[model samples]
Target: MIKVLGDSHDKEMYDLLVEVTDLRKFVEEELHVLWKDVDEVRVECQSRHASNGNASISTSYIVVGTHGIKVPKPNMYNNTRNATMVENFLFGLEQYYEALGIVDDGAKIANASNFLHESTQLW
Candidate 1:
């Protein structure tokens, strides 16, 4: 997610139309130009969206281990007896991740491996 959208100017009055609408439009226009394979951007608009978005997304992997919320672990997958409820197991796992603030995919997979029974661990 974008932490900040645009540059901050102390002397300038807060103009929603210029700062928000126009800046968003400039980014959209640039994206359209890129989609069209054109480099016709002659007018450079003041924007910090790229760096702000990158900074936020780059630090996204640093996940908080827990948020102090109670989330019961899903039932272990022992055999085909619980295979019919596989969807429930997946949903519970997702809730566990969200409640525990687990954002990194690698961490989620590694932690989820602990919930798998020996009979289903190969899958």
Candidate 2:
């Protein structure tokens, strides 16, 4: 990975890829998770690159085309950084994940970071 993606943001993906000793186990246990996780990371980077900092949409709801179906966006978590709030956030986040058809733990974990505020990111 270093040779291929040298001096780039490839550390996490490289680590996951390099630790796979068994091909069959990799396919069964790691392949899909890795792909989804990497894809999530790439999508995040691409969005940041495209936006160049101002990434939040102006509106909290998205309107689908002609039908005018409006769906509320998922809530950003960690306003107060309390345990109860975190639990509520997780519950709401899991529901959001379900609505988006995101079932894998890797993708869920990846998505969680995007919703966390700076105050709770380190915590």
Backbone clashes for every candidate come to 0, 0
Candidate 2: misplaced stretches above 4 Å? Answer: 1-71
- In terms of lDDT, the best-performing candidate is 2
User: lDDT (CA) for every model shown?
Assistant: 0.64, 0.65
lDDT of 1 by residue, 8-113 (tens): 4422446655688888999999999796654333222113324445433432343566755677777875655565577777788877787777776656776777
Best by TM-score: 1
**Please, what is the TM-score per model?**
0.43, 0.39
Alpha-carbon RMSD, each predicted model? 16.8, 21.3
TM-score, structure 1 vs. true: 0.43
Question: Between which residue pairs do clashes occur in model 1?
Answer: none
